[model samples]
Target: MSLIAAASFFGWLVGPLAGGYLAQYGAAMAFQVAAVAVFLCMIFVATVIKETHKVSNEQSFLSLFKSNNSLTLLSHPNILNLFVLQFFSVLV
Candidate 1:
C-alpha cells in the first residue's frame, strides 16, 4: 500500500513536468502522446493482468445495472448522504 502511494505521488509530481516538456512540440502532440500511453496501458492490462474475482457465468451484464442493486446501495445512510451531497454540490 505504501509503495502504491509513493508511486502515485511520484506520478503526480512528474506528470505535469513531462506534459509541459511534451507541450513544447504542440498541444496536439501532447494529447496524442497521452492517448497512445493510455492505449498501451489498456493493452498491457488486457494481456498481463489476471482477474482475482470469480464472476458468475449465469449473470447477464445488464443485470448488474438493475434498479434494485442501485437502490440497495443507496439504502445505506452514509452512501445516501454522500450521494445527496454530491448531487447538490454539482448544482452549486
Candidate 2:
C-alpha cells in the first residue's frame, strides 16, 4: 500500500509530461483527456481499493489525519522558539 501510494505521486509527476506533449496537439484535447483519465481513476479506486489499516478499523474523515503514535516531541525547548521565529518571519 505504501509502495502504491508512493508510485501514485511519481505517476502524478510523470503524467503531466505526457499530457504536456499531448497538449501540443490541442489544449482542449489535453484537458479533456486528463479529465476523463481522472474520472476513470476515481472509478477504479471506488471499485477496487479497500481499507487495510492493520491497527484499527476506523474509517472516516478522521482516517485522513491518521497518525497513530504520539510521543513528547517537544523535549527540546529551542525547537519551540525556532518554530515561533519561523512563523513570525512568514508573516511579512
Q: Best-fitting candidate, measured by lDDT? A: 1
Residue pairs in collision within model 2: none
Count of clashing pairs, candidate 1: 0
CA lDDT, every model vs. true structure:
0.85, 0.77
Question: In model 1, what is the error at residue 10, expressed in angstroms?
Answer: 4.0
Shift in Å, residue 26, candidate 2: 0.6
Compared with the true structure, the alpha-carbon lDDT of candidate 2 equals 0.77
Could you tell me the TM-score of candidate 2?
0.48
TM-score per candidate: 0.56, 0.48
Per-residue C-alpha lDDT of model 2 across residues 69-88, encoded as one tens digit per residue: 23233455787677778889
Residue lDDT tens for model 1, 1-92:
99989978987987788789998898988789878978998999999999999966676667765744667788889999999999999999
Consecutive 10-residue window with the lowest summed lDDT within model 1: 59-68
